[model samples]
Target: MKYDDFMGEVQHRLELPDTGRAVRATRAVLQSLGERLQAGEAEDLAASLPMEVDYYLESADSGQRFDYDEFVGKVADRANVDRSDAAYYAKAVFGLVSELVSAGEIEQVRAQLPDDYEDLFALIDAEEVEE
Candidate 1:
């Protein structure tokens, strides 16, 4: 999707008041996800996303490893939002991403993460089942 469309979806999905919030949340989630994923997987995911969104994933340090709580904390810090809001943002942004990317890619991302991370992707899976 185009940048505008991508942000629009994020805004709608998150029920944010404006695109600015969506942008911050999206950047937060993508950057955190980039840090979690291996360099090659990050590169692959970035390649599949819009150019604007892809920038968030570029040059991520693949060596750093953290669990779900730490991931949420990092997102909150980077997004300058509260922890609760950060978790919601992660679900919204990642749900949109799961729709945009391939199933295999989603599985690849899930494999890198712990079981706690499954809750985020479950939002996507639930939506798919509803449709």
Candidate 2:
């Protein structure tokens, strides 16, 4: 979902009065994020993005995993921000595109243990070796 929509839904869920000032605040936050992302400042992004999502999510539902669409709708409604903005924010947070790419190193060394690996301990036969 767009950033505006996400903020709007969050605002709505939180029961914040939807007003012009609230909408402006949402836009300003999103615009600032865009600027940061454009600068390729990844560390800063990692630190801030999740915190924002967590704050909004917690404030809205007090620790619940609402559907992406539902959260977006509520935020959009509350913040009076455009749905497009909410969509943008959702894409950034939930799209998983960035994670998939950045986490390539971890994907490279991937391995799956055989189910029989657990049997190795039983097969050690320590008693037989001593005898």
Candidate 3:
């Protein structure tokens, strides 16, 4: 997806008031997700994303072995939102990412995370099931 489309999708998904909030959610979720993935896997995933958001994954300190709760906490802190909103933001962002990224890369990312992180991809899975 292009940068504008990516940002617009994020804004629509999160129902945010403006581009600024969408940027925050995208940065927070992508950065937090990147940290959880290995450097190579993160880079591979980053390769498929838009220019504006890809660096969030490319520049993360990968191999940080935080669980899903900590993952949500980090996103909440980074996005300056509550934990609940952070989780929602993550689901929304990941849902969009699943479309832009290839299936093999998605499997790589899924393999890196534990089952608890499945909630993050709730929308992705649901859409797949319907199709």
* C-alpha lDDT values of all predictions: 0.87, 0.37, 0.93
Error (Å) of candidate 1 at residue 19 is 1.5
* Candidate 1 lDDT tens digits, 35-91: 888888998878878999988877667646888899899889988989998988898
RMSD of 2: 18.7
> Which candidate number would show the highest lDDT if scored against the true structure?
3
Q: How close is candidate 1 to the true structure, as a TM-score?
A: 0.92
lDDT ranking, high to low? 3, 1, 2
For candidate 1, the 10 contiguous residues with the lowest summed lDDT are 55-64
* Model 1: residue 40 alpha-carbon error in angstroms: 0.3
**Candidate 2 or 1, higher TM-score:** 1
Better of 2 and 3 by TM-score: 3
Supply the global lDDT for candidate 1.
0.87
Q: Which stretches of candidate 3 lie over 4 Å from their true place?
A: none
Per-candidate TM-score against the hidden true structure: 0.92, 0.27, 0.97
**Model 3, residue 15: C-alpha shift (Å):** 0.5
Better of 1 and 3 by lDDT: 3
Backbone clashes in model 2: 23
Model 2 scores a C-alpha lDDT of: 0.37
